[model samples]
Target: MQRLSENPNTLLALYRISQAASSANTPRDAYIVIIEELQRLYDPHAAAICLINPNTSLLEIDYALGYPPNLPELAIHPGKGISGRAAFNGEPILCNDVETDPRYVKLIEGVRSKIAAPMIAGGQIIGALNVDRDHVDGFTEDDLDNLVHIANEASRVLQSVWRKRQLVMQSSQLNALIEVGQSIVSKFEIQSLWQTVTEAAHQLTGAGLCTLQLYESKEKKVSLQTVFPENLEFLDMVGDIAVTESLAGSAIRTKRQVEFSNITTPDYRDLHDVPHDSEVTSCLSTPMIYEGKVIGIINVFTRERHRFANSERRLLQAFASLAAVAAQNAELYSRVFNSEERLRKSERLTTLGLLSAEIAHEIRNPLTVIKLLFSSLDLQYPESDPRNKDKQVIREKIDHLEEIVSKVLSFGKAPEGIFTHWDIDDLIADTCLLVRHKMGQLKIDLRHHASSRKARVNGNKGQLQQVLLNLIINATDAMPKGGILTITTKVEQIERRSVVALYIEDTGSGIPENLVARIFDSFLTGKAEGTGLGLSIVKRILRSHHGDISVTDTSEHGTTMRIELPFVR
Candidate 1:
């Protein structure tokens, strides 16, 4: 051993070990200097500084002078070997011959004496200072005492380094949570939200694979919603698993989290045969929940064996909760937005319908005067005269104009809702054929479906035709991007009276509930340039004919409009 020369040098060496913690620029550098000082004070054939691996809680030799060739492969749990026992109980051990002691685990091959002293800080044993010699009974009690003293000297430096590492880990976790929260809240689409959540999870945990498995309660099935960095073979095999079969599914079914520390082990990897599954060591799943109900599962995977910290699991739980809430809120907002838009549209159309009625009234007055003038003149002509034919054409034209004006003014009253024997199915077929060309250009598939015998109704053919045409046009406008339009005819009992019903179904944006109530009100229309009189007229004609119209159903998928006309007795 280096002659300490005097008690002053001995004191100086201990001081250096204590001061090295704050004096060195880095934790690694300080630890290196501390180990060197321990060896310099007590010369031994072999010496090493061991530290506890926090992840596994095992003693690992950080730096060793003489150990077995595969020393790095050795992991000593607390209280197992002489060094481990010293670390576990915070005591010092001086073995005169390690070969004679059962507690002394043989490491290096030779005649041996060993000494191990626990490194303690804040009343906790963190590791140990260990040394071995080639000669038997080489280390004395005084040497063991000196080793204990060295451990104490280095304790301050180790404590400082550990605390600093913990702080860094905490800062990273907090920042990750904040960024994820902002990303999820800003997303409105369900697919986009899933992507954000899964990608964030992969980045935060540094996992090899991350995924979202959504549970469809209606189907009682779990399916993968999102898989980040998508070429994982194990995930492909476990793509769709039943709740009773897989870890992620179990988490969803039970509304809890599940974890597997090493999935490649015989017990788990063999239970469910993951196809071509390789390289997965850890798996963790947290249920995505909102309002106390499980929606899906957030799964993370790692290639190296890993133990999930409680704080990390809690953070994932927080992320899943936020994702669920955000998705639910976006859906609710979409519905409310559609409803409000329809209500505003209805109000505007009603206002325009009132103005239209006034214009029709003024036009009717001028037409009556013209009719009287033609009658007062009493112009007569020969039957063969071409002028007589022209005069007759004028009369017919005026009468048609008169009919239109009357219909306009009596829009709600239905002044001309005359009943007649009308083949309803035939009428729909004709109208559909008329618009087939237009629908083709819009990429809409138009189909006419009829069941049972042809339905004949006691309704004005012209008026009913107008109503059907208006409904068809409105439905087409709803699907500007093109979709399926189905017209079906059937006879069914409505309140015990058999009525002929015409149903118009369109794969278009559904009507908002608020607007459905006022849909038939004059001047209310969905189209930007529509006068909104068509459905109002259709409602008037049907009501006058002892029939009615109603919306069968409407949603994001599409809308169905029903026209009911009482059958002729």
Candidate 2:
């Protein structure tokens, strides 16, 4: 002690300790420098600084020097060792003979004397500066006083440095989180966004696996969208958990964060489809809350049992919030895409309507000239005369020409239905009569039945007749070899609303599977000689009368089409 007071090295050591404490920019650096200075002051063989880990309530060797290379990184609890005792009590410990000290846990081969001083700042002990010497009684009372003073001065510098480092790290983490949020929100595809989120979560948390589970409202189920490692067995295990049973589900149900340290426990294993393995030990789950409701869950898995700190939990929650917003945006974009497709189809139909009008007008004049020439021929000249058969042939050809002109004229004309109260059954029977000849040509049997007291629909008489005509003709054309055509009318109560349903069924070779979808589309035809405008006209007339038509059923044996019109009442 006497030699140390006058020694030139003593003053040098004091100066070095002061400079180190002032220059350190982080708590870890300050700890290293403080321990290093203590070793120099006492000329110890080894040194270390043990601090309290707030989360686990344990003491950890944060920094050390001159110790065995293979020493374990962890240390005894806060009150277990000489250093831990001093740190916990905020006092200094002096041991002249370490072998006799119960608190001393020796790690060095020749340690005999030891001193530990609490590093106190803002009236709290953060850690302790420890020192060890090679000889017994090497550290005197003076050594304890001097080391305590040094530790006291170093504590203030360490706290300031630590706070600065914390701020910087927090700022960097926030910026990284913001960038991830931007990337997720920019994606319009749900699957792609989910993949990005899971990948980012795995990287951010240093976890072995990551997964996203989306909630289905209709089924009240949750489905896994993406998982790391691409493990089918693990996925199947996770899939077995009911939407209301797993940790992820708990987070969603409670609208809170959930964490598990040991997934291998029986409680967790019971809920999981696959037994927990050694590869997965810890889990963190957070709910994706949007509009005050939980829509999904984001989960991360670690290989080792880990207590997730508050910072990590907060970070995961932030990610989940961003994901919720991105998912909503993606859904909105999908709806817009479908609406645009419908509008495009409407525009195409409008163009076809304009072109058909022009062609009908141009063909009218030539049709009129042919009709006048056929009328000028006389077939009364005789059956014996060769000109008689020639004249008869011209007359029949003129009639066929007139029929073609009439059909074309009907297509180009605007719908002019005589609006009146009429029995739909009588109208259907009349329309079926007009198509009976055509139906006979194909060997088809046409039948009609009314199942309601009022088969009355408020619409144009002629338009309804036209609709019935188109349907019977189409049914007849569908079965060229003859089949059954049945028409039925009924009053339906759907969703508590009264509606009239007109059903037309045919046994003709059911509409070709591929053409079934486009049967109502204008200019879509299945027959080589069809005008392709019949069904289109039927659909337009129905829409004009505030009605809708849809295919009820189609199979190899038959096809059924249903038309629904809201009753006037």
Over 68-110, each residue of candidate 2 has an lDDT whose tens digit, in order, gives 5654455667887788889888889999898898988766678
| Per-residue lDDT of model 1, residues 42-89, tens digit only | 667788778887767899887776666675687889898889999988
In the predicted model 1, the residue pairs found to clash are 349-523, 349-524
Where does candidate 2 clash, by residue pair? 237-274
lDDT of each: 0.76, 0.75
Error of 1 at 160 (Å): 3.1
Which 10-residue span in candidate 2 carries the lowest summed lDDT?
Answer: 338-347
Cα-based lDDT at residue 244, candidate 2: 64
Residue ranges of candidate 1 with Cα displaced over 4 Å? 1-14, 20-27, 54-57, 66-71, 77-80, 88-90, 109-111, 120-125, 152-156, 217-220, 232-241, 253-256, 266-278, 328-569
